[model samples]
Target: MSNVYIVEDDPVIAGAVADHLATWQMQSRCAKDFEHILEEVEEYQPDIILLDIKLPYYNGFYWCMEIRKTSKVPIIFISSADDNMNIVMAMNIGADDFISKPFDLQVLTAKIQAVLRRSYGTALSIHKLECGKVELNLDTTTASVDGSQMELTKNEFLILKTLMEHAGSVVSRETIMERLWGNDEFVDDNTLTVNMTRIRRKMEAAGVKDFIVTKRGLGYIVGE
Candidate 1:
């Protein structure tokens, strides 16, 4: 599943846009904390970001720049600020596409699917896993959210990717350690703990909350 992050402020519009993505069987999230847009971006790590021009604290352009600094993910601007100057500004800041207000939902969905297909190689991929607004580009060993990218340490990426690929299912620590062996690393219990903690901090700094759930003695799981 492809994860999408929405940065629009209007509740009604945001809900509608998210609903549209869901209908297509694509997973999506509306930004919950505007001041921490980057955090939200990291937490979700969406394949694409639907950003509105007018936002709280700072405009979409500022957030776009912040995201651009770390990722090459796709960003699509969606706002009533459809003026030429704003559109140009959005594009110049690194947005992949622009969808003006009063547009058709079907049209918007089509555009989203197209962007996803192009960026992700296909619209729907089974081997891959998704969480928050982030997509683990399985084929590339990279992670993207709202058009931004994160340089994940191999161990860090592997653990989280494993959990997400099996969202709602627990993955044992022993299994995780075994997987790490493929990279010539023998991870002890504490080693896995350190890695998990670091990964969690990174995700938290990116604005995600309670994304990975610990299953007591069982291991970890990406909660649904």
Candidate 2:
């Protein structure tokens, strides 16, 4: 059973989410010390995290950043602050996905399951793949170019993996979207764009140049 750590301030919502997760055969632990959620997260070492934006002390963004410093555990933000800016900010800060407030429990469950499947499931047959001089470590969800390694969030890793697996061929936007979110119906198109931009930025920072080529009106290619 996958363990989920919920850092929601609202007791009612946290309780509801925990209960729903229980029905899905998942174990969850709620954060009681909002001021020191990082400690709780460390102690729990959950497979995934459900973070809320509005909290008692520092807020979810701060915790997300702190957690990203050492861990690549998938985080999904549940917040009423679901504006485009907030969503984009969350993604930029390393969140795997964002679900707005007043959401259906079933939808939330599905999202959680999808994220877990991607993060933990053995979808890739090989442990690593290479694009030019850059190497993607599937087991670690990180890439190294010229010996400089960069970590990737779940979305970034998935996008890069798809492109590398089909190296030299443009993987269409729709195909990538389907591979990332299981379908395009539930996710915004721009989210994929944001993930792609971040992945390219990370690659560039790690000494990789022009690693992903964008073919206008088609998709992206890793090589050739």
- Name every residue pair that clashes in candidate 2: none
Worst 10 residues of 1 by lDDT: 179-188
Q: Write the per-residue lDDT of candidate 2 for residues 1-224, one digit (tens) a residue.
A: 67999999889999989976764457899999998888888899998999999998798999999999999999999999999999999999999999999999878987887898789785422357888888887546688887778888868877888888899998999988886666449688999899999988887787778889899999999888
How many steric overlaps are in each model, in order? 14, 0
True-vs-predicted CA distance for residue 162, candidate 1, Å: 29
Alpha-carbon RMSD, candidate 2: 13.9
Measured on C-alpha atoms, candidate 1 has an lDDT of: 0.79
RMSD of each: 16.8, 13.9
Quickly count the clashes in candidate 2.
Answer: 0
